[model samples]
Target: MSGSRPAATATAAAPARPGGGMRPGGPGGPFGGMAGPPQKPLNFGPSAKRLVGRLAPERLGVMLVVVLTVVSVALNAIGPRLLGHGTDLIFQGIIGRQLPEGVTRDQAVENLRADGQNTFADMITGMSVMPGQGIDFGALQSVLLGVLALYVGASLFMWLQAYLLNDIVQRTVFRLRSDVEDKIHRLPLKYFDVNARGDVLSRVTNDIDNVSQSLQQTLSQLLNSLLTVVGVLAMMLWISPLLALIALATIPLSLIITTLVAKRSQQQFVAQWAHTGALNGQIEEAYTGHALVKVFGRQREVEQSFGAKNDELFQASFGAQFVSGLIMPAMFFLGNLNYVAIAVVGGLRVASGTMTLGEVQAFVQYTRQFTQPLTQVASMANVLQSGVASAERVFELLDEPEQVPDSTDPATLDRQPRGRVEFEHVSFSYDPDQPLIEDLSLVAEPGRTVAIVGPTGAGKTTLVNLIMRFYELQGGRITIDGRDIAELSRDELRSNIGMVLQDTWLFGGTIRENLAYGDPTASEAQIRAAAEATYVDRFVHSLPGGYDTVIDEEGDNISAGEKQLLTIARAFLADPAILILDEATSSVDTRTEVLVQHAMAALRSDRTSFVIAHRLSTIRDADLILVMRDGAIVEQGSHTELLERRGAYFDLYNSQFALPAVEE
Candidate 1:
């Protein structure tokens, strides 16, 4: 986001349209005038890797999570095996030969050893059973208790992992948001000029939110699921390699299906978010300009346009969700097929005495565990892809080109500035092929008014932008107090100048807060003095809350003229050596304009002032008047001097006084 505003030369070749081609009064213009261009899909692998790199600062927490996940998965994997051992003990006790009543346990064990049933006798002895009893209920109870402990421990570790991961993910999101905020201040104004306000806001708010949510919900689950799959596969192989191979056969099929679905779903997810941003842009534009829509009878048109965008969002979201939704069920079906194959093959192995019945049960359990994580991973594909897409958007914003670098060794004003401004042979163009302000030269000594009068698109605003260093000059230099502006830091240069634009901007704050914005350290006496000078104190006193009145975001609590006066008061409070008034009085009533002019005259008495006005009558007494046409100074002189010459300024001044004749 470059800081410089594009020059008028770039817009000259464009077709002439109202509101600069913004669809101001129709359905197509709902998204703050014009819909932004389509977005391209982001690369998933690189984006995901970049997102992971952002977590590098939390390495300790991530390592802890990895350890906990491995421990938990190991415990879970051991549970079924332990249960199977308990089952084997119970089966042995049930099938073991019965002994004579009251036979000594040692004698029964010796008899069983003689009968080739020594293992069962040993089991009976371990349980303290007298062999008269059939099953070793005591030993079975101990094995069950061990299995319960494993499960409980696994649950506890999983809980701890979730807690730690949440902390890390939240902290990472905090850093990302902070970086975005800082980047916003550094971005050039040109970025904003070409981008939608709501779209940029979407990246800052919606995209970041998506990234946070997905990381919180999916990151830990993804890790745990993958670990579980690996652990289960290892356990299965330990039980029986053949069964393990059969179970593993389903993996490639699942991967093939998941990859295809994920590819299609990711594309849809990207589109879904893009349309969502567009809809948000539309809502912001419609709501911000609600009054204009109603006054222009464009309410129906706006609604129709909004509905179209809303429908697009619906389709894209539905497509993404529906495609990703197929993953779990498909994995489940494959899992069930694998389970059947394992059960049949393992039953044969059990019959052939190659594996015990207890081991077969454990192997089947391991197979289920293996498929479960795959299913879970498949289920999370949607979230992961959406998160990656969102991350791509956020990284794209952070990657925008910043403002031009400041000079390494900057120059400063040698003494207090006298407001002497000079534009020496300054040449510039938004595009290299078409020059706008070519070889322009001007000088305004201290305490003089330079009034610039021009037709629309005559580069009046561009000239002021150049003076303020909002845009760098393509050639030559601008100097203030004989110091080149390019050599001065933007902050230092702008601090010495004050501007009150035609569009008054006031944040959502008390009137007093807005007045004190230019100089926060201003005393109450100074604040009141500035307000009184601009005649804003009259209205301030009239309001029920006085200066403390809370203005809304749009500052609609006050009339346009009152808002203008408050801005004037703000500029006056700054007391800069140079001031810019861009049609500052154009929106005020005649009485209010007269008062403001009086205040402005006093303010300009000791400062270099540049006034751009459409109404020529107000600038009659300007120290020097410049008449501009086609991006050039056609005539420049004092009011009387220009009128006597009867050139462009004469024709322009005379046209305003011309009256309509009565029609026959």
Candidate 2:
């Protein structure tokens, strides 16, 4: 139960692996068997950018959102500048009240815009200048109204832009989730063996959440900050090029610090995600094994395991958040230093009579404005990085190669199948070096029963997997009625075959609903007939609601024997031309076994059938018995003929029947 996983191999033809260290399985084999792989340190970069590219199709909406964000930030930055203008106007009014300064009101307004200098500079420099103009109440009221209007407009635009930004992000995430689901279904079964289900779930749930949070909250803010920073810098230069040059010195330093911090934080966040997935998987495993834990009285041990995983998650999360949290404070500290520099330099200029008091005031206001955006951007760095990490995980899933692709020119199923099966020199293996079936061949004529008996791992299950086309044959081919299974449409081939697995899966629903799943077109009468054939009718009628009795999740509410009988009834409803019973009666008791045997007898009447069984008693009456060992047939004959040979089949049968069962 370690969090580490097997090293995933890269396929040049397949999609790229998500960022991580690679440590393939050791010399033993690639599958890793019981032991998991070594932990790989996760990275976040190229994969994240791939997600951005995936969102490119919606670029227009994203661009529109960016534009609105810039407008919002620009308006916000202009506020202080507008205030500076108002202050100059008030100061000019006071100067006008003094001895004539040779300035008209229009010229004063124009001068404030052009030079940000007022005639009052001489008075402040030891020349007793008198007031020029009295306070104009009407003008002051108009200025107040203008300020209110500008603030209101900016607020409205900020709200609108933020709304659009969130909308665009939500739409993109919705599509991303759907695409991931589709890709997961397309992935081969082999992929699942190497990857953790909990990890995949985390990517879809928590990672997607990160992306959404960045979009809704941080995305617009980041853009606004950038625009503010740039605009403020421009105005600062206009006010005092010397001070602006001094303030600009901090920009590169801040950028370098932010970049390094963001990169480190991103890597930590990726680890956090990995641990989160591990934690989720541990919880699922603990809960699933709760019965075993309680039976063994190991509740404390379970608790300890969970605590350890939770602590790992906590440590990783704290580090990531801590580093990300430093960015804002650092940015603000630099901003404050720049502010002090501007204030001191501007004061010197005013003292030397080189700059007017109004000009100095304007420069200080612009300098503060410029630093504001940098602070905002720095604060949102965590959200942006977290989103990028989540995006990478999601995109990786979507990029997995499809294991089963449609044929280049699929053949149409134009007629009903005759149910002839032939396995020609077919060989396969879960592990490439260990062939499960080696150049083995067999044929099942229409309406015949072909029973396959073998010890565990003799490739009995693997053989069935091929017939169902679950795994492609490594060599040779399987044909149905002279048509190669590969050439035939998967749907066409599978539609003709009905399967009853050893471990029957039952969805949460009424018995009738479960039966209907096999053939939705079946009538109630037909359903009852199928049930009766499988001896399921006896159990159904015993229930208070008969077919209406609800089966709990996984059919845990019912007995195993009853569940198997219901599955058989389901196959009957499908009325497939071919049937595969894989250990179909292994779980039933003696009495139930007899009833199930009757059902099997009826089922075998007019269809091609393949039976894989551990018990020799079930196949004693089979049309043909094939004994397989180590991927090849060791014996093939009728039950008596094989037993007479006293070979592998005889030894297998004698070993089982040799033991006498005690009465319950």
Candidate 3:
């Protein structure tokens, strides 16, 4: 028996992937994948900006981190200069101890210059040396202590900055998750119908985790490295502009490497995640329908699909990781080049006495600091690219068009309406090009059991969907008690209606909890009464826990009949004015079906109910049985009346209930 899911979902031309849904850091492949129309380009700039904007709520925290980092970087920048002074102190002290007594630094310099020791004279020219004084431990100790203090302050501020940055990144990611969750609820059912569930799930769980983890890994380091570069470069320029310029010469080369590698890596990362989603979708579909796959002997095809998807993931991940990985090593190589140039230039300057040994030492330190941060930023290219790709996926989901907002001042549906439902020239189509229902008008009188009988895709469920307002109508209106359903909020409208589909869904909870889901305010006696009415109490009383018996996720403990009974009981507890039953007894044995039918009769007492049944026997006693043919009511009457008319209903009845030909 086909359940009409395809036609019910109403998906027409959305480009949904074949299979679906984690990490692809690395294996073996070329450094790229198909980055064509299927995989849209990652909107790095906008996504990154939006990610940054998530920190708006924590602006104060961000400012604190920035301030703390600035202080740390400033202190770190001055540390080497202060350390250079300490070196100067030691050098001056040692030189003064060896010099003649009563001779001043200028006098020593003048004497050295007279002797043409010009470079040596220049080396100690600015040095505070005494001609005859020994190593002055007091002044040396003071300079050493001052350098130590600067370093300690720098470390303290850096630690504080790191501590605060973690908070900002986490909170920002938290808000992103919240936004994503809220966005999911607002999206239309068509969105889910058009996309694979696993893909959407990956966007929520995997993509979001990727975004969070990436931010945690890169945010602090990126901020610190970038600031460190600026701060360190400023110090390098102040110390020796020529050496700083030499160090900077490697920038263009580093940029070239990062840009080239990133271009290839970005595409691969996108493909990697896309493949991850595709793989997940396949896994979800296969696992959920595993029994059907085995019954149909399609296990091999499913396995091959999984294998292909996994291999694609491996290819993209390997490329994304391997290609992006090249940045760090390349950057380090340029840094080494920069490091060598700085050391050589500083040594020459020191030897020429144009710069002191201590000054050259500090300048060399500054060069390493500057190059190191650049290398760090370059190394982060892979992580940044992967993260931005994930963000793009998440943003795309958030940007999906949601259902129109509920009316601000919606009309209210009574707890117990008069129960007259009317479709005035209602027209709707799953796809506009292929209309399913035309200008069809029907009135379901109060307390009537309107049986909608049809073949699969004859819009049997579609009619029910219309009554429930699951999809908006393209023309005309549906009204209950003379009030348009569109004028009421969905929650308000749905609260007065109850539905029990063919497939029963029971969460992990006690029987009592499941019953209470129908109406939270139900009393113990009322719950038991409803359960007894649906015969759920008959089975539950035999179980050890009675109402307290916990249902597993799959509800394996309950028989199919028992599950149906519980659903009916749950619906009974709801006590809705209108009930919609979608062939609830279609799969049960005759004995169970009889019991279910009785319980359904009780549930439908004095209520307007729509029963979508494939079995013609079930709707025989209906007040009005509408025989539907491709979304139109071809005939409408009671079973006896339709049989007399010999119309579509008569044909359907004869097909299902007509006796077989007599044997020869």
Number of the top TM-score candidate = 3
Query: What is the lDDT for 386 in model 2?
Result: 72
Residue-wise C-alpha lDDT for candidate 2, range 509-592, written one tens digit per residue: 999999988899999999998988888898898998889999988577789899988888898899998899999888888888
Query: Per-residue lDDT tens digits of candidate 3, residues 1-664?
Result: 0111111222232211111011111111111121222466576778889877877899999899988888988888888887787777777778787767887788888888898988778777656677887677787788788878988998999889888888888878888899998898888665765566667788899998998888888888888888988998888888888988898899998889888888878888888888887776667767766766788898887788778778888988998999999999998888887878888888888767677778888887887888888888878888888888888888889889887778999999766687788888787876767777777788888788989896777778777778887778999899988999999888888888888888788999999999999999999999999998887888898999999999997788888778877887888899988889888776577876777677777678789988999887777767888877766777777778889999888788889878999999
lDDT of 2: 0.73
Ranked by TM-score, the better of candidates 1 and 3 is 3
Error of 1 at 114 (Å): 18
On a 0 to 100 scale, what is the lDDT of residue 275 in model 1? 79
Q: Candidate 3 — which residues are off by over 4 angstroms?
A: 1-37, 97-102, 106-119, 132-134, 659-664
Output the lDDT of residue 590, model 1.
89
1 or 2, greater by lDDT = 1
List the lowest-lDDT window of 10 residues for candidate 2. 1-10
Candidate 2 deviant stretches above 4 angstroms: 1-43, 92-132, 296-301, 350-368, 541-554, 660-664
Which number leads on lDDT?
1
TM-score to native of every candidate shown: 0.90, 0.84, 0.91
Q: lDDT for model 1, on a 0 to 1 scale?
A: 0.83
